[model samples]
Target chain A: MFVRNILSAIIISVAPVSSVLAAGGDTPPIPSQDWSFSGPFGTYDKAALQRGYKIYREVCASCHSMKRVRFRNLEALGYNEDQIKAIAAEYSVEDGPNEDGDMFERAALPSDAFISPFPNDNAAKAANGGAFPPDLSLMTKARANGSNYVHALMTGYKDKLPHGVELSDGQYWNTYFTGNKIAMAPPLMDESISYEDGTIETLDQYAKDISHFLTWAADPYMEERKRTGFKVILFLLIFAGVMYGVKRRIWSNIH
Target chain B: MSNAPREKFDNTVVEWVDSRLPIFTMMKNEYGVFPTPRNFNWFWNFGAIAMFMLITMIATGIVLAMHYTADTKLAFDSVERIMRDVNGGWLIRYIHMNGASFFFIAVYIHIFRGMYYGSYKAPRELLWILGVIIFLLMMATAFIGYVLPWGQMSLWGATVITNLFSAIPFVGESIVTLLWGGFSIDNPTLTRFFALHYLLPFVIVGVVLLHIWALHVTGSNNPLGLEPKSKKDTLPFHPYYTSKDFFGIIVFIIFYAIFIFYMPDALGHPDNYIPANPLVTPPHIVPEWYFLPFYAILRAVTFNMNIYMLAGLGLLAVFMVEFIWRHKPKYLNGFLGFLLLVLGSGLAVFGLLADLNQGWEIPMSAANLAPISAKFGGVLAMFGSIGLLVILPWLDNHPIRSARFRPLFRIFMIIFTISVFILGYAGSQAADKVYFMEFNNTMLAQIFTGFYFMFFLIILPLLSRFEKGRELPKSINEAVLSKAQKAGA
Candidate 1:
């Protein structure tokens, strides 16, 4: 019955409001992709890689939990363990028992998974305002446009509305991400982080790389996916050739 | 001739700096040489100022957010924690709060500067239009950001504004509910507000990029208002403009710092000090100071029957002045231009004065009876602004070629100045309710508002036909510059 009701509502809304919704423009992609990080032919962009790392350190690591990844794993992404440890030690986590036998918080270890700073979901939601900003572990994949949408959204605000909504004195509206207008104030900034890569600190470059890092976090198996795809394609090509030869032999004999 | 050929040498320091810190090289590729006017001017600096505010607000906002709570129950306490407990958190919060005020201040100036200089005209229309877009986004972001603290003003303000959408035809209620995330402004609204507040600055940043790009494409109009003629007429963007913009930024920062540090709450509502109570509404809910002008405009219209007309008229009037005042460039001699300077300055001064004292009592009759009424200063100032702007082209009537004498244009400028002073004086008066009620009509209000609209829409366009030719001086620069300087002084 609920399904029927929902379907009926959708039909009703669409039949009348399609003109309104479709009038402004088509519904944008669910999660937009950032193509800058992934270069032509799926090559990793070095500048994007460095920027991605910077975004991780400056933004994501503050509140979000990447439970599957380790600080030390950054070394594989090309950071030295010393660099990784220095970054990890920036945050203190709860661990060993206190003198009263309660667990105590301490500096995060290179070995530790990226635990959320909040105590629990309730704490997170309470701090953020009743909405537990979801762990962005698989956010890139979960979102519609992959990484591009995130990058574009970061810098997409204008002062005026395209429609009737009136903003208060200090509020701004971003166009790229969902919500038509969003609340997550633009996070990335030019010269916000001191980059090691000598790339000029540009908001675009920063957003692009951070988005790339998030994309990787969401699907750590991206490289594997690409590899598997290539192998399957190669296998299919060889199989097609063999089948063609076999069919020719059979046909020749029959003739 | 071989005294020993001197060994060719490369400066390693220069190379190293170029490789390691290529700020200049990158700048060259993107913006070209220092002072590159290849096109811009003082009007172009606002985007940079806007960018600086975005960064300042975001940084302070994140810090505040770190200490803030989003739940309906604890959101107020969390704001208190920011004010009372966190180290330098109060300062950050206040700066963020006031930074919002200053951001609007800069934007209004930026917008007005665009208006006077014709920054939105022609090829640069997109830039001006994009600026409007940026302004809209800024408003949304600020509104949601204000609500996140969940203070009294945040709550009541949200209720009032959210309820406004219910005026829409049909699905208004549902739309409002969807916006609120519920029937009333509560947990869901707070959450959604936070999510959106967090998001909009990035959008502003995006539009700003487009704004600058549009400006770059249009280049910038010069102080002389004459298009650049040659390579000799242009300069590298670095030392010339970079230095000038840097100077502007410094001066702006000094003022910004005063507000951020000392008078932080001066622009904020006193009611916000109290915690939000959904059941209670503040006695006189007013938006921030930056929005006061528009609020005044909104309040000026007594009848809901003409709401859309009033609103549209007010908005369209903002850009109407430029068109009305627009005249053939050839006819705008130094003397005539000087008159415009005087009128423009007077209008600005009056606007500021009108905005300042919201509740000053004005004496009305022979009995010397003074009573407090809602200030009509904004209305009067706008009235003056409308008159001057709409009839500008007619007032500065000069034929296409005659630049030698600008007596007619000068007379128009004086007329514009006198009208502005009269309108400004009238604007300072409190709205007379006795007169308003006894009249039993909005005819007086309409007369003022209508004249404001008509001057631009009717008078100025009509004046274009009567304008005769004027003779030009040897140069567009010397004739206008000296005159403007004299008028400004």
Candidate 2:
């Protein structure tokens, strides 16, 4: 009954709003996929997030950076401490000045932020022909309809330019991007990154996995939050119900 | 017994303090036996709920300030650190983030309750005015608090809003600079906003104390807009209303928890998650959801001043001069009327000169013709929206409180509510976004803005003069017992 009531409420609030609040009139509608962590009671699928991390490391990491995510945070994806340490050691990060008073690099610790491909935004922009690679730590959050939008951009590339459309050097056409123009080339394809768990290795699978992964990355506390929310709301509901009874009892003689 | 001077407590500690300070006596007099109208509905819950949100915000904000770094370079990263590293910091920050929206929600419902019940009339006027003051303070607090995160929207929104100060004519640029603490919105601006954001809520609390004092003075205006007459018409403040308010607050928290836990960023703009970068502004910079209606008003007035506006103002000069001189309908005639007529004609002259100034390019930059005047006009309209609420008690003195008895007013109230909601929706869309033929969001906002002002300025006065209200109940007792009987209780 609790779940049923919550389901009705979620439907009441979400159904009409999603249909009506579609913004940016010129942009194409981003088709939403079933996300593991979509609702109030939903929790992230850890294995999917781990698979997404693989796709990110193999394909997108060369350009984008996850500046806010720490190596230790990957534990949320079911990594043990040793495994997290091993993952941390795989990438090096900038450290402090030593006896020589010069900044140096060392093997990364679990506490360190994700390593960046480019040292600075200026260098990244110069390398990419004046197009700076944005940080992806908040990418799924920093845009409206972020998860669907990113997924569409991943698989949205047009093989041939649509009628009279032309690209200027690096500019690529993506079906879902605002104005249909994007700076980066198509980043994923069939077998973009193979999964050992026997997950399908198609472009669609790759996009969905990464989208799931990025969603987890953006809000790592989803599982804990929803779990806590269930208990909190349940308690409040009971408390309110009992309080109403008490109020009735107190006011029984008022009339 | 309800109005008795004192009741001895069992504990000597209380008796000693009571003898010295009489605070215990004060509490008992003010709250313990205070007679509140027993006919309160769901709407009465909002006032206490609004107070609950205020305390919640303050509690969360104080904790957030502890972990926050005020510098421009560190502010965004510090917030991330709070989210990632500090234990339960995400919960605190998200509560504070979504708390502002919820705070506005409660307060808006509270204000609308006042409007629907005509709670602003007579002895409750100061109570309503205090509420409007608290509301203004809340807006300032929320706007400055938005800048504390130092995100793209924060920076750009700060820049745009502070630039509004430049519309002050001679001291405009200086005021903007003073607000920014520099030529641009940078570190100094961020730091100062943090300081002011922290300060404004306490100011709101002070005004809220005054608000509560005023409410206690005249007592709560119920849904029926009737004051409690005697014991039968009222309930004591102990287990009865306290129990009800607690239930209301907990239910409110349930919704707040849903936002904080599941969709924390739903009410917020995605651009805000991006750190502040002044050089590249977001393509569309919208204020937080609560500010949308006023933002729509501001944007709607972006058209050039023309002959039509001049003629409209020239016609409405009488309304302006009349609004300035008289507070009530009776005061609208005689010496005040004759004096206002002369002043009204003078304002028409000023309106003609203003029309002439549009073409001639006046020395006052804000008053200058063309685009700036329109922008300035937008700014005026936006402020006037709230400003009108401050004087609403005088504007509508339709003897009968509550729209339940006044059929015409009930219709006007519904229309006014609908228009505000429409204005809110129009504001949420892109200014140039057109859903139909020839009419864009800006034009939609414009028509509704006119409707919004007209409801207050023209409709209320007209209703006061002509509309005969239905019979009021003999008292709150008569209404409640009848309501119970109709329900077959």
Candidate 3:
């Protein structure tokens, strides 16, 4: 009886595999960049991070917010405490009531997060034609091939659309965007943000810098993580060797 | 080295504890002086490694939970805060995240090792079942824990899996509603999942304790699959196995540490880092890596049988056979048979091909008969794949317990492992999509899924009858001595 039941169950379980294949429109492939933080030994390029922060502050900060990151986290990007404080003070942030139970606006402290341009999602959407710009704090970790995708999308805006493809009023053509149309217009242009280090202020440079910065924002502990990882691995290897010797010595008496 | 009775405690403190609880005797008997087969191989170490991973997960998980917020609106941000704001929270979160993948990896190796040695046979059957129950609990725990992050994959995975319960006959919709705690996967679902996630690991710990007790009762099964007859065949577990387990653990830890620190997100889906959005779904939804093989089995079933297409293909096959036989008369019988075989297979293939051009829906009642609806069949197949493991003891009629002594069974075991990996690869692909060979991934998955079941249900039982077994050693001592003699010679 059990055998019969299993046999019937197997038969019932085995069935046809059929479904309409919903093929997505072709997206331009994201070209990989020479990231200073790609491999196990890779560390963030400090200068690139600073430039990226400039681009983010001058351009991207108008719409997108890095809500999870505080001004203090910029210390990882080679910024001094005074520089971070100055940067934080450049933006106005909402503060608590002063015995009047009324919320007041004040210059942001070094501890405060990079505040959103709009107060909430509904307001953000209203300002950006009903499309809320996603928070950039975890942006580098959120999408598949995130870092490259961000870089590509930033620089992928073409002057002409592909043959037979039409863009709606608000939608802009970006080669890297899914369906080749994105709500976000090309935000970066040549000479968008000048670097204090006298680096070239090309659109490509801005895109690369911002992608690097976002990656750092997403995982500020990458350099520390990799360094600690290497040390731990080294210690484990040495410990394992010692353990192996001990095991051999213990087993010799038995064998 | 001797099997003589243990010496009595000389110290009054030891005697006092022994008299009160006999905890010393229990430890000395169960662990210190426990008899284990001397010929047990490295594969045997996986159980200990799995235990280590479990403890690692629990310890790290406790720390993570201390910082994690279970609220829907705050869950994503709280996790980020854990990664950024909390002191060494990054280390704890990474360990817990990668620890899950490592835990599954260790447990899988342990389960496969059990299968390879036929540790589920006879006296050990209950032990294997308890292990399976633990596996079920682990899956539940992992799934719920995944939802606590409240990411894209978390929300959708919860939605997809909870919806599977809705495939029930009359109560399907209500079951989904109950599972959701409201109309859809919302705050309540996240809270309950967090609650259950926190609770199930303790339950697993309880089951694991029972699993260990069962293992101790039967003793450890060795690679040779021969029972230890005398004291010569067995050794005390403390110095020998303990040192060996310690070495194995260090090796396992090196690999675990590499993943935890170096490539922490390698095993995870990047989409999961995005906060959960009900308005949008990712292009492809897939479960974690360990669940992929079973996920593939779940997706293999399709409801549209295409009976008309099958009939048409059959008629075409008949015409082709007649045409071939008419064109060549000398090899008429062989050609006709070969043509018929080809045509029959073609007809079956036709039945399996989903009509991508048409929007045709078969009534649920009709679809549930021979070829079940894709949703219902997927749920059953997913569950049935795991169910197969529970009855594996009954499925194998072999007198021998280990594949080392059964050459034919060994080949089938290899094929079974390969098929499972193939199913895993297929499961990782976007389901319902056509890939290489113009055949959908589900169709590809179905072939492997068939092989997976066939190994247990058909090949194992039937092969056991006809396959000749190798000469058995009288005891483990004899097997070891013979091997040593061969080495010396």
Better of 1 and 2 by lDDT: 2
Residue pair clashes in candidate 3: none
Chain B TM for prediction 3: 0.86
- Give the TM-score of chain B in candidate 1: 0.67
Ranked by DockQ, the better of candidates 1 and 3 is 3
- TM for every model, in the order presented, reads 0.48, 0.90, 0.88
Best by TM-score: 2
- Model 2 deviation from the true structure expressed as Cα RMSD, one decimal place: 7.7
Which is the leading candidate under lDDT? Answer: 2
Q: After superposition, how far is residue B20 of candidate 1 from its true place, in Å?
A: 15
Clashes of each: 72, 0, 0
- Model 2 chain B is weakest, by summed lDDT over 10 consecutive residues, at B363-372
Tens digit of per-residue lDDT, candidate 2, span B166-208? 6656887788789989777789988888999989999999999
Specify the CAPRI tier of model 1.
incorrect
**Per-residue alpha-carbon lDDT of model 3 for A112-188, expressed as tens digits?**
98888888889889999988899998888887788898899899998797778787788888878776678998899
Instruction: Give stretches of model 3 more than 4 Å off.
Output: A1-24, B1-7, B304-372
Which structure among the candidates has the greatest DockQ?
Answer: 3
Residue A123 local lDDT, model 3? 88
